[model samples]
Target: MPTQQEIELQAAAFRRLQKHLMEDRTDVQNIDMMNLAGFCRNCLSRWYAEAAAEKGIEIGKEEARELFYGMSMQEWKATYQTEATDDQQKAFKTAFKENVGQE
Candidate 1:
């Protein structure tokens, strides 16, 4: 097991990452993020929901998405996400396969 301080540090890092993701939607394209960073906001939301499930806390997918996106995921998609280009789509498939890890 990690030491308490290590866990806290990781938690703080996660919060910082989540905050950045929530606020900087325009600076990061979801497809490019998936391709380069190995995950996107949707993936983060899913992981959040999975973590809740592990503790018998049932967080709905929409709720999880809202937590990550700072809005309903549908709203975020309609407002910010653009159609992926062919190269982006192809890269995302490869990257997702590599990085999805479990969820």
Candidate 2:
């Protein structure tokens, strides 16, 4: 088990990553991220929702997305999202299968 301080440090790092992705790097598209990193903002939000379920706190997907993105998904899509190319979509399918498996 990790120490309390270590857990706090990890939490801080996670916050930094979230801020970096959500605010500092809005130019990064989710499909590109998923294709490259095998995870994207949607994946993070889904993980958050799963964690909440583990803690007995109910949160829907859109709610989790809003919390993670700091806005409605529709708003975020309108403002920052771009259409993915066919190549990106193909890569994303492979990455998602490799990293996330079937669910």
Candidate 3:
């Protein structure tokens, strides 16, 4: 098991990664992320929700998304999301299945 300090460090690293994705790299679309990295902002938000659940905290998906995004999902999409290309979508399906298992 990790020490308390290790847990804090991991949290700090996660926050930095969130900032990098949310603030510094707005041009990187979620679909493209899933295609290449098999994860995206949505996946991160879902993981956040799951983590809260493990702690006996009941966080709904949208609420977790809002908390992680610092805004509503609709707002984030309107502001930064782009439509995916056909090939990107195809790649995303394979990546999603491989990484996330099923739809």
Candidate 4:
């Protein structure tokens, strides 16, 4: 079991990572991230929702995304998202299947 201090440190690390992704690296395309890392901001948001579910808290996908993004999906897309190239899309399909399974 993790001690309380460890939990706090982990939480802090998560927050820093979230900020790095959401604020510092807005230029990083989700498809590129998915292809390269097997996960992306959307995956993070989904994981956040899943965690909430485990705690008996209900959080829908869009809501969780908004919480993690600090903005609506549409706004984020308009502001930061870029169109994925064909290769990126193809790689993303494989990566998503491997990392997240079928949906």
Q: Which candidate should be chosen as best, given TM-score against the real structure?
A: 4
| Residues 1-103 of candidate 2: C-alpha lDDT, one tens digit per residue | 9999999999899899999999999999999998888899999999999999999999999999999999999999999999888899889889989988975
- Steric overlap count per candidate: 0, 0, 0, 0
lDDT of 3 by residue, 1-103 (tens): 9999999999999999999999999999999888888899989999999999999999999999999999999999999988888898889889999988986
Tens-digit lDDT track for model 4 on 30-51?
9888898889999999999999
The TM-score values for the models, in the order shown, are 0.80, 0.92, 0.94, 0.97
Model 4: which ten-residue window has the lowest total lDDT?
84-93
lDDT of 1 by residue, 69-101 (tens): 788878888887788899999898888889886
- lDDT score, candidate 2: 0.94
Compute the lDDT of residue 59 as modeled in candidate 1: 95
Candidates' RMSD to native: 2.5, 1.3, 0.9, 0.6
Model 2 residue 20 lDDT score: 100
